[model samples]
Target: MSDMEDCCDLQLCLDEIPSTFNLEKAVCNHGFFMMAPNSWIPSTKTLRRPLRLADFSASVVVSISQPPGPSSTVLLLRVHREQVIRMLRLSERDERNVKEFHKVHPEAKDRGFGRVFRSPSLFEDVVKSILLCNCQLSSKRKKRRQEKDGANPVPAEMEGEEVDLGNFPSPKELANLDADYLQSKCKLGYRTNYILKLAMEIEEGKLKIDGYEGVQDAASCRILIKGISGVGSFARASVLMCLGFYDEVPWDSETIKFLKHVHAREGCTKKTIKSDLKEIYDKYAPFQCLAYWFELLEFYERRFGKLSELSHTMYHKVSSSTQMREFNHNHVL
Candidate 1:
């Protein structure tokens, strides 16, 4: 019950840019901590190991405005300053790559795409990924309806009337919950069983869900997590990204589509996409490829709608800034 002071002048960072939504609330609700802001408790032994916000740097960049007008805003967060620098250099890395992406579709450059920031916690990243599984863009509305009807959606806080279940549940709590209880909380449909099994496995020490720093390789950790039930290729890749392991390629449906139409014209099988992504990014060290893949996907999504055919071309674009900005803009506004 000790108070943890705001070690960094995050407010200065916030003041430097104009965000359409509240960045502090977005970060908190995204589950950086269970308690409210300015009232942070010292991290538990387990939480301290995987969630390290203090070690990283974050920034918010708005594309439409130079000083960032109140209307259009882009928020970027990065764990390592070097990663942020590398992402900024992506536009310059290969003019051909940028132009080629645009040549296939002119609007690609206009689409405000690129890394905004990075977070240090794998826990936050993993939790956000779980919240996104099997859920369609339209289902968000349905979730609201369910909440209004007293469906008792997950116990997470509601930003206004909408439930903000994007935060990761505590491992202790998740491990203790039954399959039926979790389904009721998450409204996960068929994915409920998978979540329940994952929880139980993690709880039982069958899965090492935490303590990732000692692990040297992202692929090895991904392989371990993928062994858990309901942890598919997409989920495993996401877990890697969240943990500061940047070399993975998460192949969600949108990424699949983008590859087939935009990146690889001959039409891509899942195998080819994986191989090509690995080959194209092989020159970069493992994990660095993650940022590239993420930027590519974000560019695609921003230019096109969430469900657009172009979304499937790239891999690993699910950054917290994009998710938070979208959730706040759509739900809070």
Candidate 2:
């Protein structure tokens, strides 16, 4: 570790950033890591063969030929050496936001609240948000099919399913893909049209997806994001979360359930969701999303382990068996 400490040695350090940048909270920072396609191994925090933004010509390939284990973070990082550098661009705005957040919620200073996980490209984030809405049905179908075939039907990683957890297809790549191919191969369902429409828009210059990099106002940003076909309020909020805007909470059924079960609140229907959230978490101000997420992670860590520590097999078992308990014996005691 000491030998690899210099930025020049690894070519990973920005002018001021340290070699030992912390990624401990990345797994719990957002749903991207958890819901990511199979190429992303959550346990080790390794993205296999991610495409570098600098070079779309080919993926930054690295071999994971050996068996999975409780590999060191250093070992895992070797697999994504270049992509890590591209993903962690700490801008002045990000720094200011992080400092402001910690000042308001000093307790979250070390808990990784301010720094959320993001995809290497905005295009990836947009597509991932679409996938989040539709993939559950496909996963269910896969689960049923596996059961019928008497396959292990456990987590995909444990089965060593040799699928290409390939690079998130670029807009050009996606624009070229037909609807049938996206639906059949990517299991995108009806989301296939939305994704293709977005990709085509980008490809044709009707929408400047990269211009969103300068977006400052969350409300305006949400409006712009929601204009994408099939993007609803929840999906817009999620994309905002990934983009470092935490003012809006992505309140969907999962959010409602978590709020009710954890806060012991009743009568929290969709109509009253905003008021219910405000009553419980307005104290955190602009960083209310962080507060909600940290508490959620606390619940998950108690029931399982830190999500990043769970191996593929263990992750499947826990994800399948664990239900949210309003009052866990451990919490009560």
Best by lDDT: 2
Candidate 1 residue-wise lDDT at 30? 19
Per-candidate TM equals 0.48, 0.74
Sequence-dependent TM-score of model 2: 0.74
The candidate scoring highest on TM-score is 2
Off by over 4 Å in 1: 1-121, 131-168, 201-206, 285-288, 291-298, 301-333
Candidate 1: residue 230 Cα off by (Å) = 2.2
Give the per-residue lDDT of model 1 (tens digit) for 1-333: 111233221212323223223222122221222211111111210011112223323222211101234443443332232322222222232223334333433342354322222233344345446545544645555445335535444222221122322222444556676777655444556665665666676667887665663566766786666676766767676666555465667666566676656666355566577776665555544534434554564554466434222111111123222232232222211
